[model samples]
Target: MQWNVQELENWEELRTYVDTALLPLYLYRPEKPVKEHVQRMSYLVQVAASIEQRLKGRVLMFPLCYQIGDEPLAQRLPAGFAHYVLLQFSGDRLDAHEGEGSRLRLTVGDEDLESALRFEVTIDVLSQEIIRHWQHGGRQ
Candidate 1:
Protein backbone atom coordinates (compact mmCIF):
# COMPACT_ATOMS: atom_id res chain seq x y z
CA MET A 1 0.00 0.00 0.00
CA GLN A 2 1.08 3.57 -0.69
CA TRP A 3 1.90 5.90 2.18
CA ASN A 4 -1.14 7.91 3.21
CA VAL A 5 -3.19 8.66 6.30
CA GLN A 6 -5.70 5.88 5.62
CA GLU A 7 -3.01 3.32 5.09
CA LEU A 8 -0.94 4.69 7.92
CA GLU A 9 -3.86 4.03 10.25
CA ASN A 10 -3.74 0.36 9.39
CA TRP A 11 0.03 0.28 9.37
CA GLU A 12 0.22 -2.00 12.35
CA GLU A 13 -2.02 -4.56 10.72
CA LEU A 14 -0.31 -4.10 7.36
CA ARG A 15 2.99 -4.82 9.03
CA THR A 16 1.77 -8.28 9.80
CA TYR A 17 1.46 -9.08 6.09
CA VAL A 18 4.44 -7.26 4.71
CA ASP A 19 8.08 -7.77 5.53
CA THR A 20 9.61 -5.17 3.24
CA ALA A 21 9.25 -1.45 2.75
CA LEU A 22 10.01 -0.13 -0.73
CA LEU A 23 11.29 3.39 -0.89
CA PRO A 24 11.71 5.06 -4.26
CA LEU A 25 14.36 7.77 -4.22
CA TYR A 26 14.30 10.18 -7.13
CA LEU A 27 17.68 11.85 -7.49
CA TYR A 28 17.97 14.80 -9.84
CA ARG A 29 20.43 17.56 -10.62
CA PRO A 30 19.07 20.94 -9.58
CA GLU A 31 21.44 22.58 -12.01
CA LYS A 32 19.93 20.81 -15.00
CA PRO A 33 17.51 22.53 -17.34
CA VAL A 34 13.81 22.40 -16.44
CA LYS A 35 12.90 20.19 -19.40
CA GLU A 36 15.56 17.68 -18.53
CA HIS A 37 14.58 17.62 -14.90
CA VAL A 38 10.92 17.10 -15.74
CA GLN A 39 11.73 14.27 -18.10
CA ARG A 40 13.81 12.54 -15.48
CA MET A 41 11.12 13.00 -12.84
CA SER A 42 8.53 11.58 -15.22
CA TYR A 43 10.65 8.52 -15.78
CA LEU A 44 11.22 8.07 -12.08
CA VAL A 45 7.52 8.23 -11.29
CA GLN A 46 6.62 5.80 -14.06
CA VAL A 47 9.21 3.28 -12.97
CA ALA A 48 8.15 3.57 -9.37
CA ALA A 49 4.50 3.17 -10.27
CA SER A 50 5.30 0.03 -12.19
CA ILE A 51 7.00 -1.49 -9.17
CA GLU A 52 4.13 -0.56 -6.88
CA GLN A 53 1.58 -2.08 -9.24
CA ARG A 54 3.44 -5.38 -9.45
CA LEU A 55 4.14 -5.72 -5.75
CA LYS A 56 1.04 -4.11 -4.29
CA GLY A 57 0.19 -6.57 -1.56
CA ARG A 58 3.67 -7.66 -0.59
CA VAL A 59 5.46 -4.32 -0.24
CA LEU A 60 4.53 -0.90 1.05
CA MET A 61 5.67 1.89 -1.29
CA PHE A 62 6.55 5.09 0.44
CA PRO A 63 6.04 8.41 -1.24
CA LEU A 64 8.73 9.57 -3.63
CA CYS A 65 11.71 11.15 -1.92
CA TYR A 66 13.26 13.84 -4.05
CA GLN A 67 16.95 14.49 -3.55
CA ILE A 68 19.05 17.21 -5.07
CA GLY A 69 22.69 16.56 -5.79
CA ASP A 70 24.09 14.26 -3.17
CA GLU A 71 21.76 15.33 -0.41
CA PRO A 72 21.75 13.15 2.71
CA LEU A 73 19.17 10.33 2.64
CA ALA A 74 19.27 8.92 6.12
CA GLN A 75 17.12 11.64 7.64
CA ARG A 76 14.35 11.09 5.13
CA LEU A 77 13.82 7.44 5.85
CA PRO A 78 10.91 6.28 7.99
CA ALA A 79 11.54 4.42 11.19
CA GLY A 80 10.68 0.87 12.35
CA PHE A 81 11.45 -0.95 9.19
CA ALA A 82 14.00 -3.73 9.55
CA HIS A 83 13.78 -4.89 5.95
CA TYR A 84 13.87 -1.82 3.74
CA VAL A 85 14.76 -1.58 0.05
CA LEU A 86 15.74 1.68 -1.51
CA LEU A 87 15.31 1.98 -5.25
CA GLN A 88 17.22 4.98 -6.54
CA PHE A 89 16.99 6.51 -10.00
CA SER A 90 19.50 9.08 -11.18
CA GLY A 91 19.65 10.93 -14.47
CA ASP A 92 23.22 12.16 -14.44
CA ARG A 93 25.12 8.91 -14.93
CA LEU A 94 25.35 5.94 -17.25
CA ASP A 95 26.34 3.65 -14.40
CA ALA A 96 22.76 2.41 -14.36
CA HIS A 97 22.87 -0.59 -12.14
CA GLU A 98 24.32 -0.93 -8.66
CA GLY A 99 23.23 -2.81 -5.55
CA GLU A 100 24.70 -2.90 -2.10
CA GLY A 101 23.17 -3.45 1.29
CA SER A 102 19.45 -2.79 0.74
CA ARG A 103 19.75 -0.14 -1.96
CA LEU A 104 19.52 -0.57 -5.72
CA ARG A 105 20.36 2.29 -8.06
CA LEU A 106 19.25 2.52 -11.65
CA THR A 107 20.41 5.24 -14.01
CA VAL A 108 18.02 6.73 -16.53
CA GLY A 109 20.53 6.25 -19.31
CA ASP A 110 20.20 7.18 -22.99
CA GLU A 111 18.57 3.96 -24.05
CA ASP A 112 15.84 4.19 -21.43
CA LEU A 113 15.41 7.89 -22.04
CA GLU A 114 14.97 7.36 -25.76
CA SER A 115 12.12 4.88 -25.62
CA ALA A 116 9.27 4.38 -23.19
CA LEU A 117 9.10 0.66 -23.98
CA ARG A 118 12.75 0.17 -23.10
CA PHE A 119 12.29 2.14 -19.92
CA GLU A 120 9.33 0.00 -18.83
CA VAL A 121 11.27 -3.17 -19.61
CA THR A 122 14.18 -1.98 -17.53
CA ILE A 123 11.84 -1.20 -14.64
CA ASP A 124 10.17 -4.60 -14.91
CA VAL A 125 13.50 -6.40 -14.78
CA LEU A 126 14.66 -4.35 -11.83
CA SER A 127 11.37 -4.87 -10.02
CA GLN A 128 11.66 -8.63 -10.52
CA GLU A 129 15.18 -8.57 -9.17
CA ILE A 130 13.95 -6.84 -6.03
CA ILE A 131 11.10 -9.30 -5.55
CA ARG A 132 13.47 -12.21 -5.94
CA HIS A 133 15.82 -10.74 -3.38
CA TRP A 134 13.00 -10.14 -0.92
CA GLN A 135 11.54 -13.61 -1.39
CA HIS A 136 14.91 -15.17 -0.62
CA GLY A 137 14.95 -13.28 2.69
CA GLY A 138 16.92 -10.31 1.39
CA ARG A 139 20.70 -9.86 1.55
CA GLN A 140 22.79 -12.09 3.73
Candidate 2:
Protein backbone atom coordinates (compact mmCIF):
# COMPACT_ATOMS: atom_id res chain seq x y z
CA MET A 1 0.00 0.00 0.00
CA GLN A 2 3.02 2.21 0.15
CA TRP A 3 1.77 5.69 -0.64
CA ASN A 4 4.29 7.63 -2.53
CA VAL A 5 4.73 11.30 -1.68
CA GLN A 6 2.52 12.23 -4.55
CA GLU A 7 -1.15 12.52 -3.38
CA LEU A 8 -0.67 16.06 -2.18
CA GLU A 9 0.74 17.05 -5.49
CA ASN A 10 -2.71 18.06 -6.73
CA TRP A 11 -6.47 17.78 -6.43
CA GLU A 12 -6.96 15.06 -9.05
CA GLU A 13 -5.14 12.35 -7.13
CA LEU A 14 -7.08 13.16 -4.00
CA ARG A 15 -10.32 12.59 -5.87
CA THR A 16 -8.89 9.47 -7.48
CA TYR A 17 -8.10 7.82 -4.16
CA VAL A 18 -11.64 8.31 -2.89
CA ASP A 19 -13.04 6.81 -6.07
CA THR A 20 -10.70 3.84 -5.93
CA ALA A 21 -10.53 3.12 -2.20
CA LEU A 22 -13.62 4.46 -0.43
CA LEU A 23 -16.67 4.00 -2.68
CA PRO A 24 -16.89 0.23 -2.53
CA LEU A 25 -17.12 -0.01 1.24
CA TYR A 26 -20.69 1.18 1.80
CA LEU A 27 -22.31 2.56 -1.33
CA TYR A 28 -25.58 0.63 -1.58
CA ARG A 29 -26.46 -0.11 2.07
CA PRO A 30 -27.59 -3.67 1.64
CA GLU A 31 -29.74 -3.49 4.75
CA LYS A 32 -31.90 -0.74 3.38
CA PRO A 33 -34.79 -0.89 0.93
CA VAL A 34 -33.99 -0.02 -2.66
CA LYS A 35 -36.05 3.14 -2.35
CA GLU A 36 -34.17 4.05 0.80
CA HIS A 37 -30.81 3.91 -0.91
CA VAL A 38 -31.35 7.43 -2.06
CA GLN A 39 -31.97 8.69 1.45
CA ARG A 40 -29.06 6.72 2.75
CA MET A 41 -26.90 8.06 -0.01
CA SER A 42 -27.98 11.58 0.78
CA TYR A 43 -26.90 11.15 4.38
CA LEU A 44 -23.57 9.83 3.24
CA VAL A 45 -23.26 12.79 0.97
CA GLN A 46 -23.59 15.31 3.81
CA VAL A 47 -20.90 13.63 5.83
CA ALA A 48 -18.47 13.19 2.95
CA ALA A 49 -18.94 16.78 1.92
CA SER A 50 -17.56 18.10 5.21
CA ILE A 51 -13.97 16.86 5.11
CA GLU A 52 -12.58 19.68 3.05
CA GLN A 53 -14.06 22.23 5.40
CA ARG A 54 -12.88 20.49 8.54
CA LEU A 55 -9.39 19.77 7.28
CA LYS A 56 -9.09 23.04 5.41
CA GLY A 57 -6.04 23.06 3.14
CA ARG A 58 -4.68 19.87 4.59
CA VAL A 59 -6.76 17.49 2.46
CA LEU A 60 -9.02 17.40 -0.57
CA MET A 61 -12.22 15.37 -0.83
CA PHE A 62 -13.56 13.13 -3.55
CA PRO A 63 -17.13 12.60 -4.70
CA LEU A 64 -19.94 11.94 -2.22
CA CYS A 65 -22.01 9.69 -4.49
CA TYR A 66 -20.93 6.37 -5.92
CA GLN A 67 -22.86 3.33 -7.12
CA ILE A 68 -21.99 -0.09 -5.80
CA GLY A 69 -23.48 -3.57 -5.67
CA ASP A 70 -25.89 -4.24 -2.81
CA GLU A 71 -23.94 -6.92 -0.99
CA PRO A 72 -21.03 -7.47 1.30
CA LEU A 73 -17.61 -7.67 -0.24
CA ALA A 74 -16.77 -11.20 0.89
CA GLN A 75 -19.96 -12.59 -0.57
CA ARG A 76 -20.35 -10.64 -3.78
CA LEU A 77 -17.92 -7.78 -4.19
CA PRO A 78 -14.58 -9.62 -3.92
CA ALA A 79 -11.33 -8.96 -2.10
CA GLY A 80 -9.44 -5.70 -1.90
CA PHE A 81 -12.44 -3.56 -2.69
CA ALA A 82 -13.37 -0.04 -1.82
CA HIS A 83 -16.22 -1.64 0.23
CA TYR A 84 -19.01 0.85 -0.59
CA VAL A 85 -19.16 4.58 -0.81
CA LEU A 86 -16.24 6.28 0.94
CA LEU A 87 -14.71 9.71 0.90
CA GLN A 88 -11.03 9.75 0.02
CA PHE A 89 -8.08 12.07 0.58
CA SER A 90 -5.05 12.75 -1.55
CA GLY A 91 -2.04 14.88 -0.85
CA ASP A 92 1.72 14.84 -0.71
CA ARG A 93 2.62 11.57 0.93
CA LEU A 94 5.32 11.16 3.50
CA ASP A 95 6.03 7.42 3.48
CA ALA A 96 4.42 4.02 3.82
CA HIS A 97 4.05 1.70 6.78
CA GLU A 98 2.46 -1.56 7.91
CA GLY A 99 -1.17 -0.79 8.67
CA GLU A 100 -3.03 -1.97 11.79
CA GLY A 101 -5.00 -4.80 10.16
CA SER A 102 -4.17 -5.23 6.48
CA ARG A 103 -1.11 -5.94 4.42
CA LEU A 104 -1.57 -2.80 2.41
CA ARG A 105 1.02 -0.18 3.18
CA LEU A 106 -0.26 3.29 4.03
CA THR A 107 1.22 6.66 3.54
CA VAL A 108 1.75 8.97 6.47
CA GLY A 109 -0.34 12.06 7.19
CA ASP A 110 -4.01 13.00 6.69
CA GLU A 111 -3.94 11.79 3.10
CA ASP A 112 -3.66 8.21 4.28
CA LEU A 113 -6.57 8.39 6.71
CA GLU A 114 -9.70 6.43 5.73
CA SER A 115 -12.16 7.28 8.46
CA ALA A 116 -15.62 6.52 7.09
CA LEU A 117 -17.15 9.11 9.44
CA ARG A 118 -16.22 11.46 6.69
CA PHE A 119 -19.28 9.68 5.25
CA GLU A 120 -21.31 8.85 8.39
CA VAL A 121 -21.46 9.32 12.15
CA THR A 122 -22.27 5.87 13.51
CA ILE A 123 -18.65 5.04 14.29
CA ASP A 124 -17.60 8.46 15.40
CA VAL A 125 -18.34 7.83 19.07
CA LEU A 126 -15.79 5.07 19.20
CA SER A 127 -12.93 6.58 17.27
CA GLN A 128 -10.04 6.64 19.71
CA GLU A 129 -8.71 9.90 18.41
CA ILE A 130 -12.04 11.51 19.09
CA ILE A 131 -12.79 9.67 22.32
CA ARG A 132 -9.42 10.47 23.74
CA HIS A 133 -9.96 14.11 23.11
CA TRP A 134 -13.63 14.17 24.07
CA GLN A 135 -13.87 11.94 27.14
CA HIS A 136 -14.46 13.84 30.36
CA GLY A 137 -15.31 13.28 34.00
CA GLY A 138 -18.48 14.28 35.75
CA ARG A 139 -19.17 14.12 39.47
CA GLN A 140 -17.29 10.91 39.78
Candidate of highest lDDT = 1
Give per-residue CA lDDT, model 2, range 1-140, as digits (tens). 11234544564544434322222123453565876655555544444444233433322333443435543333222133221222312221122222221222111123213455433343232122222322321010
User: Among all windows of ten consecutive residues in candidate 2, which has the lowest summed lDDT?
Assistant: 99-108
How would you encode candidate 1's per-residue C-alpha lDDT over 1-140 as one tens digit per residue? 77778867887777877655676666667777989878776776667667777877766777767656765544344555545666665444222122233544444453447686797787778777877777666653
TM-score of predicted model 2? Answer: 0.34
Report how far off residue 21 is in candidate 2 (Å): 9.2
What TM-score should be assigned to candidate 1? 0.72
lDDT of 1 at 62: 72
